[model samples]
Target: MLTIRRHLVDAIVEHARKDHPDEACGVIAGPAGSDRPERFVPMLNAARSPTFYEFDSMDLLHLYREMDDNDEEPVVIYHSHTATEAYPSRTDIGLANEPGAHYVLVSTRDEDTHEFRSFRIVDGEVTEEEVQVIDGE
Candidate 1:
């Protein structure tokens, strides 16, 4: 099972809604352990593509360096599907380099609006996981 903060889910939905026609992306940071293998703090990357997201290499480098400085590693990567379901695309699967990190998808294609899902892609295989959003104190 995958667990995420409620605020993180809201932020992802908001980002997806705000980015409408394009894809919005960001990073998830937290502890990845057996007891809580998927707990994260979502960080919105203001730097994103309006038509296509090509993970800003500079921003990625900065984020990595910052994480190193703070001693917190990026445990997951999230992106939105403006018009499609919350699932990985072929390109997404092909470009995913982190086998141990969670891949989250937020879908904003319906009238009700918010939908979030999490998955893991390893060796070209995609496995969906249940996400339980926990309200933080």
Candidate 2:
């Protein structure tokens, strides 16, 4: 299971709504502990497609270096489901590069509300997990 912050979830929902008719992608960075394996630090992705998403390699690389410098790690990769359910697509499953990282999906198909879900994709198989959002500090 993944424990995301309430503020982060709200941000993602807003992003999804703001990017209506297109997909929005982002990165989540935080410490990983036994009790809270994944925490979220929402990031914006300038490069996104309506039907797909691709992290900007340059931006990602820069953020990676920055995170490393800050002694933080990206624990989750997130994207929005603009017109679909909060589930992984075949493309998303196939593009799972971080087996250890949580894959978060925020569904924005109804009422512009956010329904966050978590998953882990390994070897083309998707295993759904529970997501608990806690109030932010």
Task: Report per-prediction Cα RMSD to one decimal.
Answer: 3.0, 2.4
- TM values, all candidates: 0.83, 0.85
Q: Give lDDT per model, in order.
A: 0.72, 0.75
lDDT of 1 by residue, 12-75 (tens): 7777787766788877765433233233434443445443456667777877787677666666
**Error at 36, model 2, angstroms:** 5.2
lDDT of 2 at 29: 71
lDDT per residue for candidate 2 within 1-137, as digits (tens), equals 88777777777777777876677887767654333333344455555566687777777888788767766666778888777898999999988987877888888778636678889888888999988889855
* Candidate 1 Cα lDDT to native: 0.72
lDDT of 1 at 93: 91
In model 2, what is the error at residue 113, expressed in angstroms?
3.1
C-alpha positional error of residue 20 in candidate 2 after TM-score superposition, expressed in Å: 1.7
